[model samples]
Target: MKVSIKHLFAAVTLFASSTVLADVLADIKPLQDRWAEVNYALPEDDREKAFAELLANADKVVGGNPDKAEALIWRGIIKSSYANAKGGLGALSVAEGSKADLEQALKLDPTALQGSAYTSLGVLYSKVPGWPIGFGDNKKAKELLLKALEQNPQGIDPNYFYADYLAGKRDWAEALRYLEIAKAAQPRPGRESADAGRQQEIAALLAKVQKKLKK
Candidate 1:
């Protein structure tokens, strides 16, 4: 048996690369959780300052790691900056950038990034409409949500987004199922809000959405 020096070097490099990726994947989630908390705490009337903070953090996430897939998730999220709060053709500009990032993320690694790219696209579509139009699209939303679920059934964002879509479509049963899954995935209290307030709000909204859909 003859093992060449090249083979040994290649094996070492692969191991190192995998370790780096694992570390990044591990770190990204906590950052994501903090950002989610911040988003939840922000007042309902506006999302600009929150969006600004979100974009800044997301940029940091992408900047810290040059990996295409990892960068893509942050980029996709940043792209949808004010789509939900101040949507219009103006918001469309941001959405375009977000779309590009998610697409790149998918191309790089559809399975990695915890299906973040797909989940983000699902979220954006659910909140937005057709091109040059407003911010809302059920069909596209459903498609992306299913894709995200297919990629990562256990992911929180996917469950949240998909659950929202189901509620939008008046599928209360399914929506509840997914929302429960999302809640179970991480019960941690949001940092943005003092303590239980965020939880109460989220729970209330979930209940309201479910009730509306049930009717």
Candidate 2:
């Protein structure tokens, strides 16, 4: 079979793009896994240092693939986690950077990584102090989180985050429902450690909601 030179070049270009994308995603996986470990298993005092190291690596990933929304989403996730770990006035700068990364990711591809930008942004808005303190807004958090749910209704992160939002609002019944959905969420392929760690969080939160119900 004879192939035209133009067709051959196009094929090579497509393959190269695909390969690079795959490699980028692969590089991000361990960073995510380490993040789950640091967030859930590391001692409180150790979290900041661990996240700082991970953030540097995440910055490289984002810098290497500025056009890839997937990379941007992970960058935002790492920044947000790091900000949470490194609280106080110093943390706001990191959180703002995270918010920018997420916003850019959303603008590039809202559907990337099953809508994780929305989830991360939602959590940020929900947790950060509002107004004179910071940019947090419960209303914006609800909007973003629900948008994330619309994109990935069955996703563990979406359900878990929404449940947390509801709990913060003191809407116990709705929070419990979402928590149950999160508990029953199917494990993500190749992310067993993260799933397991998140499930532990779900169980702890579930227990809290149940205790609240009894009150």
Candidate 3:
């Protein structure tokens, strides 16, 4: 049996690409773990410092793999989480940086990590103040969140963030539906901590939506 030169070359290229992807995932796993730890396990008063430290490590990862969408996505996540922890006007700058990182990740690969860039960016758009104060736009947030749901219908982050958006819009019924789906999402391997933390958030939101419906 003889393999054509073109076929051999293609195989080699595919293998190299796969290897690079594996390396990127391996490198970002630590970032992901630490983020969940800082965001969930740490006390609220302590999280800002922890997240700031994590952001430094995330910066190194993004710098090392500037083209890896996964790395950029994680960096963006860390930045946004740090901003949330910091709070107030001072945090807006970090949030803007987070938006930029997520945008870059989208350009590199919109579907990387199950469209996480879209989910995270959508959350930013939904949460931030609009116009003079910030770039938030509910319309853009819905569009991005819907795209993320299309890409990852059953993903925990997509459903959870979309539900949060819907809740913000006072669409209680729709929010409840998505929160239910998010609550029941299958846990991701090697992301047990994140899954657990997100489940807690989902439960809290679910209670809020359910109470709103009863009101």
Candidate 4:
């Protein structure tokens, strides 16, 4: 079979692009793994310190790959997780940084990491104090979470975060529905630790939502 020169060039370009993407993922995998470890396995009292260290690594990754959406998304996730561990007013700045990272990731590639930027940013909007304090907005939170779900219909993180948002809104039935879906999500390869941790969260939320429904 004879291939046209145009077709040959296009094939080579496609292969190069795929190789670069694979290398990017490889570079970011450590950040993702450490994040899950710190967020899920560390003791509460120790998590803040661990997350702080992880944030340094994440910053380096983002710095090295400024244009890689996956790197930015993982950095955002780490910052947000660090904020959660830090808690209180002291964490607000870190949260804001997280929001910025995720927003940039969205601009670069909204669908990267299965729309994780939307999921994480939606959770931030839902959890942060609103008005004079932070940029929290329930309306915007729901919009972003819904978009995340649209991108990752069977994703554990998206479903769980959206369910948490619904529960906050006192929408018990809807929260339960999403929680169930989250609980049944397929295990993500190379993410067993994260999947396990998320499953536990889903179980706890499921129980709470079910109790609310019974009331």
Clashing pairs in 1: 127-135, 128-135, 128-136, 129-135, 129-136
* Clashing residue pairs for model 3: none
What's the CA RMSD of model 3 in angstroms? 0.8
lDDT: worst 10-residue window of model 1:
189-198
Model 3 CA lDDT for position 103:
99
Where does candidate 3 have its weakest 10-residue lDDT segment?
A: 126-135
Q: What lDDT tens digits, residue by residue, belong to model 4 across residues 13-90? A: 999978978988998899888888887888999999998998898888888889988999998888888999899999
* TM-score ranking of the models: 3, 4, 2, 1
lDDT of 2 by residue, 1-215 (tens): 99999999999999997898798789788788888889888999999999999999988888888888889899899899899989998999999999999999999989988999999999999999998989999999999999999999999999999999999999999999999999999989988888998998899889999999999
Query: What digit string (tens of lDDT, one per residue) describes model 3 on residues 25-49?
Result: 9999999999999889999999999
Prediction 4 TM-score vs. true = 0.97
Q: Root-mean-square deviation of each candidate, in angstroms?
A: 4.2, 2.5, 0.8, 1.0
Clashing pairs in 4: none
Q: Which model is ahead, 3 or 4, in terms of lDDT?
A: 3
* Distance from true location, Cα of 166 in model 2, Å: 0.2
Report lDDT per candidate. Answer: 0.70, 0.93, 0.95, 0.92
